[model samples]
Target: MVQTYTSPIRVYKTPFEFVMAAYEKRFPTCKMIPIFVGSEITSEITSEDKAVTVIERRCKLNVDAPYLLRKIAGVEFVYFIQKNTLDRRRRTLVIEAWNESFASRLVIRETCKYSVHPDNDDWTCFEQDAHLEIKSFFGFENAVEKLAIKQYMANIVKGKEVIDYYIQELIDEGVTHIPRFVPTGITEDSALDQSGIEDEITLSSLNHMALGATASSMTMDKRIHRDSLYKLDADYIHRCLGDLDPVEESRIVELKQWLQEHHKEKIPSDAHLLRFLRARGFNVEKGREMLCRSLIWRKQHQIDRLLKSWHPPDVLKTFFPGGWMDGYDDGGRPVFVLRLGNLDVKGVLRSIGVDGMLKLAITICEEGLVKCEEATRVQQRPVSYWACIFDLEGLSMRHLWRPGLKVLYRIIEVFEANYPETMGRVFLVRCPRVFPILWTLVSPFIDENTRKKFIIYGGEDHQQPEGGLTEYLDGKSIPKFLGGDAECGFPEGGIIPRSHYLPDDLAEMESGIDSISINSESLYQSVSLVKDSYHEVPVIVHDAGTVITYDFDVCKGDCIFTVLFTTSAVKIPSSTPPASPALQTSISVIHPDLKLKEVIRPIPCSDGSSEQGTHVADKAGTYILQWKGVDPTASTAVHSQFSFDFGLTSPPKCKVMYHYDILTQDEFRGSLSSVQSFSSLSMA
Candidate 1:
C-alpha cells in the first residue's frame, strides 16, 4: 500500500536570505539530527552570474528498525539520493530526495521547498510532502511500512527545530544578516565577501516594513476569526485549539480545508472538527466518515436548535441527579456533578423510556459545549473540555438494570461518535462494590484516551485534603453533601415517586414537546403474548459463518425464549409469520421422523428481566426466535423479590421488546460475556 503525507505551510519569522544561510550550515551532518549520518556531494553547478545553483548528494541515514528486521534486510544505514535546486534570483529553493536502498521492494520519496512569503518579502515560508510505498518487505510489509512512516514523520517534526537551532548559532556568531543575491555578473565568491556588511536602510523604510508586517499579521488573525476562514495560523491554532504536533497540525488543516471546499455553509468550529479527528486517531478518512454521519444526524434531529427550542420535562428536572455548577475546576474548566448512585434508573426509564433518556444525555453534551466556550472566553485560554464528578455513594444493582444500561450504551455511542475528547477529567468518587459491574460493561466502548482521564476512588477518600477532589477542584465548589460547606444548587435526587411513571400514551405525548424520541424510529419491536401462545421472528441466513445476536427485555410476565433452525424445505416468510400451530406447540415444523435442531435451549425469562446471547449459524437456513408465554406460577423464582413491584395475579398479556443484528464472522469482534458479568438475570 502506498501512503502520502503533506505538511502545512510553516512560516519562519526571518528573512529568506538569512534563513537560507542558516539552512546551508546544516549540510554534511548536524548534531541536532543524529539519525542524519552524513551527506557527500556528487555533483555541483552554479550559473555564471551566481544567481542559481544546483547540487546532487548521496545521503546516509541510520535506520531505526528492529535488529531482526535489520539483519534480515542486511543493512544498518539506508541511503538516499538528494538533488537541490536553489534560485537566488527568485528567492526559492526546492529539494527532492528518493531512497537508494531496496529501490525495487520499497520506495520513499520526499520534497521540501523554501521560498519568500507571498505577503512579506522579509519572511520565509516552508512546506514539505512525501510518499511511501512498500511493495514487499521480507514478509514484514506492514511493520516496515509503519516504521518508515513513523521515522519519516519524526524527522519532519524535527526539521524546523534543527533549522532554528542553527539559525540561533549563526546569530550568536554575529552572522545575523546575509545580503540577498543581485545579478551583477560577478562570481559567487566575490559576492560572498561583501555579504558580511549590512545593507543601508532609511528609518522611514524600516518603520514602514515593520508596520506592514504587523498589519498583515493582524489581518490574518482577523481572517481566522471571520466566517470566511483561510489558512490556519500557528498562533491561532495554539490559542484556540491547543498544541498539536506537525503531523496533527497538518491533519487538522487538511480536514478543515476539505470541509471548507465541500461544506462551505455549515462548517463546524475547528474545536468540533478536532474532537472528531482525535476520536478517529487522526485518520482523515475515518474522521471524515464519522464527522459526516454526525452532521447528518444533527440535521435530521435539528440538534443545532435544541438548546433554544427544547425544554426538559418536569420529571427529569426534579429527578435527574446531574447538572452544571456555577464554579470552575482548578484548571478553569466548567464543572458538572452527577449523583449517579442516587439516580433511579428504573424510574426514569419508566417515566420517559429509552429515547427520552438519550435526549437528556445529548442535551447535557450540547450544554457542555456551550459552557466550554464560555469558560474559554472568560478564562482567556483554550477550554475545549469540562470536568465531571460522579458521586456513586448509593450505587447498587438497580443502576445496572438492562434497559437502563442499554440507554447508557446508546448515549455513549452518540457521545463518542460526535463529542469525543470533551471530557477534561472524571472523578468517580465513593464507588461501591457494584461499581465495577457498570464500569465493566461500559469501559470497552469508551475511547482509551478518554478513559485515561478518569480518576477512581473506591470510598470516602475523595473528601481527604490530599490526593482527592480538592486537588482538581476548588474547595468552595465542593458540594455540601460531600462534606463541604457550599450548598450544591442541583437537586438532591432520591427514589422517584411511583406517580411520576408515565404511561406509553402519555410519554409519547410528552415526547412530542421535543423531537427526540428515538423509539419512534427504533429498530427494536415489541410484541404482546397471550397465555399458551408464542411470538416468533424468522431470520434468513445465507452464509454459514454468520453470527446472530439477540437482546430482549421481558417487560411484563414470565415467558420461555428459544432459538431454532430448520433443515426441511419449508418456505420462510420475510416478515414475522403469525404464531402457527407447529411453532406454538412443537417449536419447529420439521418432519416428525427428523430431529429438531435447537440452536439455543429454551430459557425461562421472568418479569422485569433481560437476556442477550449470540449463536453462530452452522449452515445457511431459516433461524427463528420464538418466545412462548409461560405460567408464571411454574417458576418458583418468579415469586421472589426478583419480580420487583409486580402483583401475584396472573397478567392477561406478557410483553417483550427485542432487537437482533447479524454480523459476518469477520465483523464479530468480541463476546459480550467478556465485558458483562451477567449471562442472564432478573432483578427485583
Candidate 2:
C-alpha cells in the first residue's frame, strides 16, 4: 500500500534567487541535517548565458531504519535519483526525486517546488509533496510505513531550516542578495547569452538544512530570535496542532510564571496552557484566572477519577440515546455525533431523571477528555478537546418541553462552566426551523467564546455544493448519513417505547420529586420546622411484616426522630391528596377516632453525627417518620438576641438535616440474618 502526504502551502518572505542560494548550500554536507550523507553531481547542463543550471545527482541518505531491517537489507545508506529544473526566466525551481536503492520492494517519491510569491516579488512560495509505497516488504509493511512518514515529517521541518541556515551563512558573510539571473551576451550560443535550466537536469538532495532558515532565507538572521517565527516551542507544537499560536511569548512566560508562583500543583504544560489562553484571546490574567478556577473545580469534583469511575445507570445506557462515534474529525479531535430529533426526550427523563441525565452528561464530557488525551498520544500532538456534531434532523417544538429544556439548559450551563474550551468545534447540521427557537432560548447561556466555534447549517445546507464538511473531514471519516462515504453505525436512534419503562415506583424514584429518593448530591435534605409543627414523611406499607430501614446524616440543626404508624381500623382521609406522602395537619386529624402510635422514641446517638433505625410493620398502616425540632435555646452552643418567644405569630423555628430509605420483606433477609448473627455472638 502507498501512503501519501501533501503539505499545506508554505510562504517564505524571501526572493527566489536568495532562496536558491540557500538551497544550493544543502548539498554534500550540512550540520542542520546530519542525515544527508552527501551528493554527487552525475550530470550537469548549463545554458550558454549561465542564466540557468540543470543538474542530475545521486543523493545518499543515512536511513534511520531498524537495525534488523538494516541488516536484512544489508545497507547503511540509501540512494535517490534527483532531477532539478531551475527556470531562471520564470524564477522557479522544481525538484523531483525518487529512491533507487529500494525501488523493487519499496518506492519513495517526492516533489518540491520553489517559485516567486505571486503577490509579493521579494517573497517565495514552497510546497513539498511525497508518496511512499511498500509493495511487499517481508511482512514489515506497517513498520516501514511508519518509518517513511516519520522520516518525511522530520525532513519537512529540517528542510525549511536548511534555507534559513544558508541564508544566515550568506548574511554573516555579507552576501546579502543574489540578483535574478539575466543573460548578458547578444549571441544565443554564448556562455553569457544562453537561457538556463529550462530543458533538463535531475536535482537530488535528501534533507533540507534548517527549518528556521530554509526558503525563508532573506529573513533568516532576523527570525532567529523573533518570538513568533514559528509556533509555540517546537516540543509543544509536536504535542497536537503543530500550528496553534498562543497570544505571544511574553504572555506565555507571564502566565507560566504566575502559575508557578501562585498555583504550583495546577500548573499546566505550555501546550495545555495554550488552549486556555486561546479561549480567553490570550489575555494572560484572564486565562490564568480561568485556569486556576478550573483546576479548583476539577479537584473538588475529583474529575480526574470521574472518567474511569462514573458509569451511567444501565437503564440510561440502553434507553437514553446518542453515543460517541468510532471515528474522528479531520484534525484528530474525537467526533461525537448525536441526532437530537430522534431521541425520546420525555422517555429519557422519565427513565433516568434529571440527576441521572446530568450524571450521563458529565460522563460524556469526561469520556471526551479521555479520548482527546488518547488522540494526542496517537497523533503526537496536543489535542485537549473534542469536536461534537449535533444533527437536528428531527428537532421540533415537542422537544422544547419546558421542564426538559430547563434540564438541558442547566446541563449546558454546567458544561460551559466546568469544561471551558473542551469543544474544539460544534457542527450543527440539518437544522430545522424550530432549532432557531431553541437556540434563541439557550444561545445566551453559551459562552461567547464557545459561540464563536459553532458552525450551523440550515436544512441541507451542509450537503450543498459550497465548502461543507468535506472541506474539513476526510472522505472515509465522514458519516454516510451525511452524504459522505464513511459508514456510521452509532446512535441507533428512535423513540423508546413506554413499555421500556420499569415499574412505576422505580420510575418515580428514578425521576425524583415524586418519590422518597433524592440524588446522592442531595442525600441530606434540610427541613425548616416550627415548635408545634412536625416534618413528616409517610410510608404506606400494603403487606404485613414489611421492614422499613432508614439512615440520615445530620449536617445542621437538631431534631427528635420517631416512627408514627397508623392503625388498620382508621380510614385514610378522603380529602388527602393521593400522592401526598405526608399530612401537613396533625396525624390525629386523619386518624380521629383510631390508634395513631409512636413505635420508636428518639433513638440514642452513639455519636452526635447521624441516625439509623429499622422497623417491622406487623400490620398494614401508614407509617410517618417525623423530625420534631426543638427550640435552639435548649442547645449547648447558644448565642441569641431574643431571650424568649413572643407568641404563636412570631414563634421560633427549628431545622433538621436528614435522609431515609426502606427495604421491604425479602429485601431485608440479609439484614435479618446479619442481626441474628450479631445476637448469637452477643449471647456467646
Candidate 3:
C-alpha cells in the first residue's frame, strides 16, 4: 500500500528566510525532536515512514491516524508534538516534501533551460551542484524539467573536462577547492610564516576559485586544504585579487581569450575586468593594450630577466628614495606596506612583469624632473622688496617707502656721503631720491579733516566747545543772539563819532509839521485856544489840530478867561452836542499827561431880556467854559468845568451846526442852559 504522511510546513521565497522562520517556529515549544535536512533523494516510502515517526513523536498522533498533508516545492517544514508514555514529553519535528505535479509543471514551464554541450557552454559545475542541493531541499518534483536546473546541469556536463583541468591546476598550486568536515590547520602563525612566493601562489589560486571556477575535480581532502588556506589568509587572498596586474600582458590576453571563448556563458565580461583594473587605479585602456602585448611576448628575453631578478626591495628603493621602508621593516621580516607608491604602483608593476617596471620608472622620473624645473625657476626669479617708515607727520613720508622711494634715497645718501663729486657726474640724485623727494613735497595736500567733514556734514557734533566761543557757537542759543536789540555805540571821546548823524537836509524827513496864525477875536471860535485860555506860547499840535494841552486846574477852580469875540445866540457847531440839561453842564478837561477827563460845574446862562453882548466881558484872553445843573431831585446840584489850552488861532470852527430857532426866546434863554438845549447847536 502507498504510505502517506503529514507534517507542519512553512514556506518562504528564499532558503535563508525559510531557515530563520523554521527556527522561530520550533524553538521553546518542543526540545526533543529529530530534524534532518539535506539535498538528496530517497524512496517515497522511506520518506513517508520518517515523516510518520516525527509526527507521532512530536505532534502526538497515532501511527495509523489519518491526516492532511500540504507541501510546497523548494520549501521545508518544522513541527512539534508530545512523545508517548505516562509522563508525555514535548518535542519538535521537521520534514521535506515535493509539490504536486501541476505546480511543478508550472515551475518547469516558466524557467529557462539549456542542453549540455562540450564547448561554447555556460554555467559552472559548482553552481550546478548548488542547484541540485536547492532542488532536493525543496522536494522539487519536476526539478529535472525546470529550465534553471536543466541549463545548470547541461553546463556542468559540457564544461566537465575544462573544469576538471582547472581544479587539478589549483590543487597543484597548493589550493584545495572542495573542503570536508575536518579541523583545518589555518593558525595565524602558519600564515605569517608563509614564504612570499607561496603566499602569492596560494592567494592567486584561491581568487580564481572564489570568482566562480569549477572545483568538481577537487577531492574531499583537497577541498579541506583549500578551505584551510583561505581561513589562514583570506585577507591576503582578497588583496591579491584587487592587485591583479591589468598591464601583465600575458595574463590579460589569457583572461580576454577565456572571456571571448565563453562570451555566451555567464563568466565575467571584459567590462568586469575593466572595472577590476580601474579599482586598482590602472589606466584601463592603456593597461589592457599593454597586458595584451606583454602576453604575446610572454617569453621575451627582458620579461624573463625581470621575473627572475626583480625584487620588491629594488623597486621600492628606486621609486621612493630614503623613506621607502621606514615603517615597513618589522623585525627584518619586511612587513607589507600599503602606502600610495608602494602597494598601488609597485604592486601592480610586480604583477604585470618587466614592461610595468619600465612604465613606473618613466612616471617617477618625469615627476622628479618637473619638480626640479619648478625649483630652478623659483630660484632664478627676482626677490620682492618692501620697506616702511614710521612716526611721520605728512602722509608722503609714510607712503614714500611703498613706491620704492626708500631704495632710491639709500642710493643717493650713499653716493653723497661717499662720493659727492662722483654723484654730480653720475646724476644719481636726480635719477633717484632727489626727484622723488621733490615730487612728494610738492604733491597737493589732501586734508583728511576736510574730507571727513565733507563726508559727514549733516551729522551732529557731540564734542564740548572750548574757550568763551561756546555760547556763540551753541546751536540752541543762536536765536537769542540774532533777535536782540541792544544799544551799540563807540566809546566816549573816541576818535570815531559817538553816533553817526546824517545832515538834516540829506535826511529826507517826513512832512508831519505845520504852522498857522489867528487873531484874538477869531480865537473865541477856536475851542482849542479858548480852552487853553488863549495862551500865545508856541504849542505843537498833532496832525489832528486838536490842542493837546489844557489846564484842568483852572477849569476845576472856576477861573474865567476872556474871549475877544462878542457872544452870539447862534450855536457853535461840533461833532457831538449835549443831549440833556445835565450833559450840557458836563465839562471835559485835558490833563497835563494828555489824558482827557469830565468835570461837573455850574455855569450861568444869559437872561433872554439881556442883550446877547451883556455877558461879554472886557477880558480878551480865550476863556474856558464851566457849567452847573440840578440833579434828578431838582434839589441837589452838580457843576462841570472844561478847559482847553488852545493856540492863538480862532478855535477851528466846530464842524457841527446847532439850531436855536426851534426854542421860544424865554425858553431859549436861561441862567444855566439845559444840556438838552444844545441838541440843535450848529457847526460851521
Candidate 4:
C-alpha cells in the first residue's frame, strides 16, 4: 500500500529570485535544523550561456527513531539524493528528492517546486508533495508509516520560518536584490555588461538547468470569478482549508465545464466545487451529475431560503439534545455536539412529523455555513469546515427504534447530499457494542471518504494514555462532562417528556406537509378481488373556479389515480362517522346513483416519483378522488414472490403514497410564488 500527502502552498512575500537565494542557504549545514546533518554537492551542470543550471547533491539526515530500531536496521545514518533544476527564462525551480538508504525495503519520494506567483510575480509560491510506500518492513509497516507521517508533519510547519531567517540574513548583508535573468548570448567581453553585473548571472547557460520549461499546467477560467460568492484563485482552496492537491485544480476545471453545460445558473466557487469533487474522489463526471441533481432539488424545495425561514419546534429546540456550541474546538472551526442517547427520536417524530424534522436539520446546516465564514475571519485563513462530537453515553437499541429508522435514513440522505465536506473531525466516545450493528446498516449509504473520518472509542479507550478525544481537541476546551474542565451548560439528555407532544393535526400544519408513510401496514395490502376495485374520498366545492391541487408520491408500487366529480350533490347523515383521511379511499364506488362528471388521470408514477398538479373547477358539486387497481390477468391476488416476467399479474399489494389540499380563489392569487407557504390538507 502507498500513502501520499500534499501540503498547502507556502507563500513568501519576496520575489522568486530572492526566495531562491533564501532556500539555497538551507544546504551544507544548519544549526537551526538538527536532523539535517549536512549536504555536499555531488554534481553541477549549467547551460552554455548560464540560462539553466542542474545540481545534484547527497544529503545526510539523522532519523528520529529509537536507538533500538537504529541498531536493528544496522544503520547509523540515512542518506537522500537531491536534484534541483533552475530555469532562468521560465522563472521556475523544480526539486526532486528521494531516500537512498532503504531503497529496497522502503520507497520514499518527495517533490517541491518554487515558482513565480502567477498573480503577483513579486511573490513566490512553494508547493510540496510526498509519496511513501512500504513493501516490506519486518511486520512493522504500520508503525513505520505512522512515525514517518508524524515527523513529516512536524518538519513542514517550520519550513517557512527557516526561509524567513535566511531572507533577513541576506537583507542584513545588503544583497537584497538579484537581477532577473535575461537571455544574452555569450558576452564578447566576458565582463561587466550594460547592467554593470557579471555574465554568470545571465540566462545564456541556463539550458543546462533542465527545469522542465513547459510551464505549470495550472489554469483558471475567467468565468469562474463572476459567479462566485468569494474570489477564487488557483490556490483558493488551499488557502481556505490549508490542504489541497494539484489534481483537484484539474478536477475543478472539468466540473466547471460540466456545470456550464448542464446548469448555467449555479455559480462556481473553488470552495464549492472542491467539496463535490472531494466527495466523489475527484471523479469529475460523477461529481457534476450529483451536484446538478442537488441544485435542481434545492430550487424545487427553496432550500436557499432555509436559513432565513426555518424554525424548529419548541420541543425540538429545547429537548433534542443537539446544538452547536457558542465557541469553537480550539481550531477556528465551529463545534457541534449531539447527545445521541438523550434524543427522543421516536417522540420527536411523533410530535413534529418528518417534514418538520427535515426543516430543523436544514436550520442546523445553514447555520453551519455561517459559522464557517465567521471562523475564516477569526482564523485569518479559510476555515470552511467544522467539527462534531458524538456522545453515546446513554445510547441503546431503543434509540434506533424501527418506527423512526426510516425517518433517520431520510435525514441522513438529505444531509449527505446537500452538505458535502462540512465535517472536519467526528469524535464518538463510549459507543456501545450494539452500535456497529446499526452502523453496518447505515454505513453503505454514507460516502466512503466521509466514513473514513469517523473515529470511535469504547471502554477505557475514552481517556488516559489513549487521549481519545484529546487527540483532536484541546484538553483546555474539552467540555466538563467529557472529563475536561470546560462547562458545556447543556442538558443531561434523556427521554423527552411525552406530555409535551403536539397534536398530530397541529404538527402537520406547522410543517406545511401532511406526509403518510407507505410502509407495509395500510397503503400496502393484499388485494384478492376478481374485478376492478375503487377507493374514493369525497370532496365538496363551495364555489366555482377554485384551484384544486393534488400531490402524491409512489413509495412502493404503482396504482392508477383519477379525480371523479359527482354530478349530483348528496349530503351525509349526521350520525355517520367522518372518514379516516389517511386511508379515506374506502368509500363504496359510485355506480347508478351519480354520474362520473370528470376523469383527471395523470401519467403513471414510477418508484420514488412525485406527481403534483392543479385544476380549475368550473362547476360546484361533490367530487371523489379515486385510487384503483384492476389488472385483467387473474381472479386471485397476484403472487408476492419475486419474478422478472412482465406478462404476469401485478404484485398482490400495490403501495400508493398520496396527500392533497384545496385552495380557494383568493388563496390561489399568489400560489405561484407562495406554494410552500400554503397549509396542507386538514386531517378534519
Candidate 5:
C-alpha cells in the first residue's frame, strides 16, 4: 500500500531568507525519502499523481517536483515559501521549520567541513597572521591604506602645483600676500593614528591639510605663519607710535593698546598708515605734527640767534639815513632837462624822495629842449642859418613830441609858437637815437613837404648837402665861394638865351646872387605865333621882333604863341625891351599854309548856363571862331585836324598838363602852374 503526504513548509520575511530556510529545513529529509522509497517510490508515484515514501511518512509529489527541488537546495525554506507558496499556513510552517533546521544544519556542516579540511583552518589562521604582519610592518591595515598614503603624497604634490599657479596669478593681478615655506614631506605622525586619527590631531591635521590644499589649489602661499606672529610689546608698540607724527602717533598708540588688550589679530603697518595719511592730503613726508614741531623749533632758534646778534641803532641807520639828499640841487626853480639816455625816470623818481620829480620828468620828456646857445648862434647868421635852426628844432621838438593825433594839433601849436621863423626856412633835423622816435611820433602830423625834407635828410644812404643842419650842429662853417676867372665871358647873339656861362662861373661866384643877362634878340628869337589871328593881337618872333600890329582887320582870326627860354642861368632877368611889331607879319609870311581869319567878340553865356560834367563837347566837327579877345578882329579857330591828328583837344586837357609837369617843366613852375604851353620853336 502507498501513503500520500505533502512536504513540510516555512515562512520568512524576505524572499531570499525564506527560500534559503525552506530548503535547509526540507532538503535533507527529502533526500532521505529517495533512499527510502527507491524502487517502491517510482511504483507508487505516477507521472501526474505520485507518492514518495520518506522517513515514516508518504509524500505526494508532482512530476516537476524534481526540477523545483533542485532549485530549492541551499535556499532558505522560508524564502522559498515566501517566493513560491500562496498558502499562509504553509508559508508559516516553512519559515518556522527553516529557522530550526538552519541552525542544526549549519552546526553539522561546520563540523563536517572542519573535519574534512583541518589544514584549510590552519591556512585561514595563517592568512590572519599574515595580515597582522603587514599591518605591523607598514603601520597600515591593508594595501589600500598604504595606497592612501601615496595618494596623500600625490595630493600634496598636486596642491603645490595649484599653489604655484595661484600665486603666479595673484602676482599678475598685483595682490600682495605673505610667503610661506613649502613642506617637503609629512614631518610627524601626530596628524594620523593607527585606527584613524585622534580628535585634536584630526582637527589640526584637517585644518593644515585643508589650508595646504586650498592654498595649493589656488596657487597661493599662506599669509600667516608662526614666524610672522609677533608678541605684543609695549616698547615696540611705543616705537611704532613714535614713527608716526605726534597727533597720529597718539591715536595709533591708543589703538595699539586696545588691540593688545583685546588680543586682536590684525594691525596696520607703518607703510599702510602713511598711505592713509597721504590719501587724506596730510603731509606724510615730514608728517603733519612733526612738521609743526620742526617749524616751531626753527622759529625759536631763529629768535634766539636774532636776540644774540641784533643791534638796533645799526639796523635803523641802514634803513633810514638822516638826510638822503645831501648834495642835490635845490631852492632854484626846477628846470627838467631830458638827458640823452633811456632811463626809467618814473621808477627813479619813485626810488628818490623828490616831491614832483615824476611830473617834471614826464613834462620834460614830452616838451623837448632847444639849447639857447645853439639857437642864438643859428639866428645870428641870416642866410639859411635860420632854416637850419628851424630844421633842428623841428627834429628835436615837433617830430619828437607829437606822439598821436589827439596831441598832434596841440604839439603843432606849441612848435609854431616856439619856432615862428621855421615857416621861412628849409628845416632839417637829424639825430640817430631820437630820430626814430621823432619819425614815428610826428610822421602823421606834418605836411608831405616836411616829410619829404625828413626823408631827404635821414633816409638810408642819403647824400647830405655841404652845409646842412648836421654840419651846423657839429660846429662846421658854410663853404665860401671863390671869384670867377677872366675867361668866363657871357655868350653873344643867339635865338634863345645861351646862359652856359652862368653854369661855368657858378662855383666861382663870391656873391650869392644867382643871376644872368641875355641880349634882346636872344630872348625874343624863339617866340612864334599860331596863324589865322587878328591885326591888333601881336605874336613874338624868332627874329628879335613881335607881331604887335597884325592884319586881322583885313585878314581872319586870333592867334596863339609860345615863348621859350633855357633856365640854366642862376638868376633870371626880370625885364626885357619890347620886340618890333614886324614879327607878326613875318610869322604870317613864314607860315603861308595857315589861313588867315578875322577875330570877333566871344559871346559870353549867362551866369549859370554852363554846368560841370564828365563830357565836354557834343559835336565831332570843327567849331567856328570864338574867343574872349580884347580886339574885335581876334578870333580863335579850331581845326578838326588839330583834334584828331594831334589828340591834344581832348576832354582831359588837365591830365596832359600834369603829366608834362614832372617831365619837362621847372620844379617851382610845375608845382605852381595850371596852364601848359607847347612850343614848336622850342623843339628846334
Candidate 6:
C-alpha cells in the first residue's frame, strides 16, 4: 500500500528573494541535519538574463532504521536524485526528490514548492507532498513503514526551524534583502509589472546587501486570513484545532474538501468536522456519515435558529439547577455547573414531561456552542469543548426514579449523536455511594471516549490539595459551596410545587402524546382517566408461567393501579376500543355487575413517581391491568356519578404513560428489584 501525506501551507515572514537565499544555505552540507551527509551537483543551467535557474544533484543520507535491518541491507547509506527549478521572474521554486538506491524494493517521492503568499506578497508560503510505497522489506514491512512515517514527520517539523535559523543568521550577518531578477532589455515599469515587486537593482550577488528593502520580521504569526478558504495554515491548526498527526491532518483536509465540493452552500467549521472525525476515530467514511446525519437533523429541527428563538420555560428557569459559570477553567474552556444533588428530577419530569426536558437540554447545548465560539475569540485560542461539574452531594434513590432516568437516557443519546466531543471534562464532586449505581445504569449508554473524561470525587476529595478542582480551575473561580470564595448563582433547586405543574390535558398536548390513540413513533401508550371511572386492558397469555412486566408513570392527579386475572372472558364495551393489538389484546369497561378476581391488590400512584412490577402467570388466562382514578382528598374511593361534589368546579382527570412486555420464564431478565408480594396473589 502507498501512503501519502500533504502538509498545510506554512508562511514565512520574508520576501521571496530573501527566502531563496535561506534555501541556498542548506545545500552542499549542513550540520543542522545530521542525516544529510552531502550533495554534489550533477547538472546546472541558467537563462540568458539570469531570471531562471535549474540544478540537479545526487544526495547521500544515512538510513535512520534499526540496526538489524541496516545489517540485513548491508549498506552504510542511501542515495537520492533531487532536482530544483527556480524562476526568479515568477518568484517561485519547485523541488522534486526520489530515492535512487532502493528503486526496485522501495519507492519514495517528494515534492515541495515555495512561492509568494497570495494575500501578502512580502511573505512567502511553502507546501509539501510526499508518497511512500514499500513493496517488500525482507518481512519487516510494517516496522519499516512505521519508522519511515516517524522520521518523515520529525523532518517536516524540523524543516521550518532550519529555514528560520538561516533567515536569522542572515539577519545577524546584516543581509536584509536580495533584489528580484530583471529580464534583459526590460524597462523599469515592465520589470515592476512582471515581478509585482520594487527592489534595488544594485545588489545582484549575496555579498552586496541592500539595506533599504523592507526587513522581514522573525516572529511567527499564527492567524490565517478568512478569505483564503482553499488553503489551511499549519500554525492555525496548531493554535485552534489542537495537535494532529500527519494522517489525521490528511483526513481533515480530505473530509473538508469533500464537504466543500458536495455541500458548498454551507460548510461546517473545521472544529465541527474535527469533532466528528475524532468521535469516529478519524475514519473519514464513518465521520462523514455521522456528520451528514447530524446535519440533516439540525436542518429538520431548525437548530441553527435555536439560540435566538428558543427560551427556557418558566419551570426550567425557576427549578433547573444547572447553569454556565461566569468564569472559565484553566484551559480557557467555559465551565458549566449542574447541581444534581439540588435537582428535583422527579418533580421536573412530572412538570415538563420527556419532550419538554429534551428541548431544554438541546437548548443548553446550542448555548454552549455559542459560548465556545465567544471563548475562542476572548481567550485567543481554541475552545471547542466545555467543562462540566456535577455536584452530587444530596443525590439519593429518588433520583433513580425510573421515569426520570428515562428522560436522562434520552438526553444522553441526543448529546452523543449530535454533539460529539463537546464535553472536554466532567467533574463529579461530592459523589455519594449511590452514585455508582446511577453511573452503572447510564454509563453503558455513554461513549467510551466520553466516559473516560469523567473525574469523580467522593466526600471531601475534591477539596483536597492534590487532584482537586483547583488543579483544573482557578482558586478564585471555584464555587463557594465547594470550599471556595466564589458565589454560585445557579438555582438551589427543590421539589416543585404541585400547583405549578401543568394540568394533565395541557401536559399531554405539550408532550405530543395523544392519549386518544396509539402513536407508532413511541413504544409507550398514554391514557387519561376521570374520577371513579376505571380503565382496563386485558392481556391474553398462551403460555403458563410467563412473566408479565409493566412500567408506568402517573403524569397527573392521583390513582390506584391493580392487576386482575380471570379464566372467564371479559366483556367489551363499544364506547372504548383497544388502542393497539400488541399490549391491549382485549378491553373491558367499568360495569356495576362486573366482578373480576384480583391478583395484585390496588396500589396508589400519584404524580412525580414511576411504578414498575412483574407477575408470573400460574395458568394461561386473560389478565387485566386496571387503573382507577381517586379523589386527591379522599381515603375511600368515590362513586363515578358524585365525583364532582368533592371538587367545587370540574371533574379531576388522571393521565398515565405505560408499557408492558411478556417473556417466558426462561427468557425473563428483569433490571429492577422483584416484588416480594408476588406469592401473595389473592382472589377476591
For model 3, residues 246-269, the per-residue Cα lDDT tens digits are 122223333444444434323332
Name the better of 2 and 3 by TM-score: 2
Q: Where is model 3 more than 4 Å wrong at Cα?
A: 1-291, 307-325, 328-684
Per-residue alpha-carbon lDDT of candidate 1 for residues 113-187, written as tens digits (9 for 90 to 100): 998876787889887878899999899999998798789778877888988998899999998778778667656
Q: Estimate each model's TM-score.
A: 0.64, 0.42, 0.16, 0.46, 0.14, 0.77
Pick out the ten consecutive residues of candidate 5 with the lowest summed lDDT: 653-662
lDDT of each: 0.78, 0.68, 0.25, 0.67, 0.25, 0.78
lDDT of 6 by residue, 1-684 (tens): 678877788899899999999989998987788999999999999988787899999999987888998888888898999999998888899999999986888899999999998879799999888899999988888998998888788778889999999999999999987877767788755887756543323222221343323331111111122224545788788888888876777678778767765774578889899999999998888999999999988887777887778777788888898888888888888888888998988678658766667778888898888899899888878889999999988997778666577668778888999999999988988877566557767888999999888888877888887788988898667888888767777678988888777775665565545321212226577777766766677788888988888878787788889998877666565455544222232234334344567899889898655787778988788888888777776654555445556557776778777888788866663323322222221111
lDDT of 2 by residue, 110-219 (tens): 99889776568788877666778899888888998988877887787777778887888988999977876656744434422333343222111111244433454434
Q: State which candidate, 2 or 4, has the greater lDDT.
A: 2
Give the top-scoring candidate (TM-score). Answer: 6
> Which residues of candidate 2, in runs, are more than 4 Å off?
1-247, 264-269, 380-385, 497-684
- For residues 581-668, what per-residue lDDT tens digits would candidate 5 score against the true structure? 3422332354444344332233332211111111111222211221121222223344432435453542210000000001112211
Q: How many backbone clashes does candidate 4 have?
A: 17
Report the C-alpha displacement of residue 511, candidate 3, in angstroms. Answer: 99
Q: List candidate 4 segments past 4 Å from native.
A: 185-239, 242-360, 374-409, 416-684
Per-residue lDDT of 282 in model 2? 70
Q: Is candidate 4 or candidate 5 better by TM-score?
A: 4
lDDT of 3 at 429: 10
In order, what is each prediction's RMSD in angstroms? Answer: 11.3, 23.4, 50.4, 18.9, 51.9, 9.1
Ordered list by TM-score, greatest first: 6, 1, 4, 2, 3, 5
Q: At residue 381, what lDDT does model 4 achieve?
A: 87
* Local distance difference test, candidate 3: 0.25
Model 1: lDDT of residue 474:
79
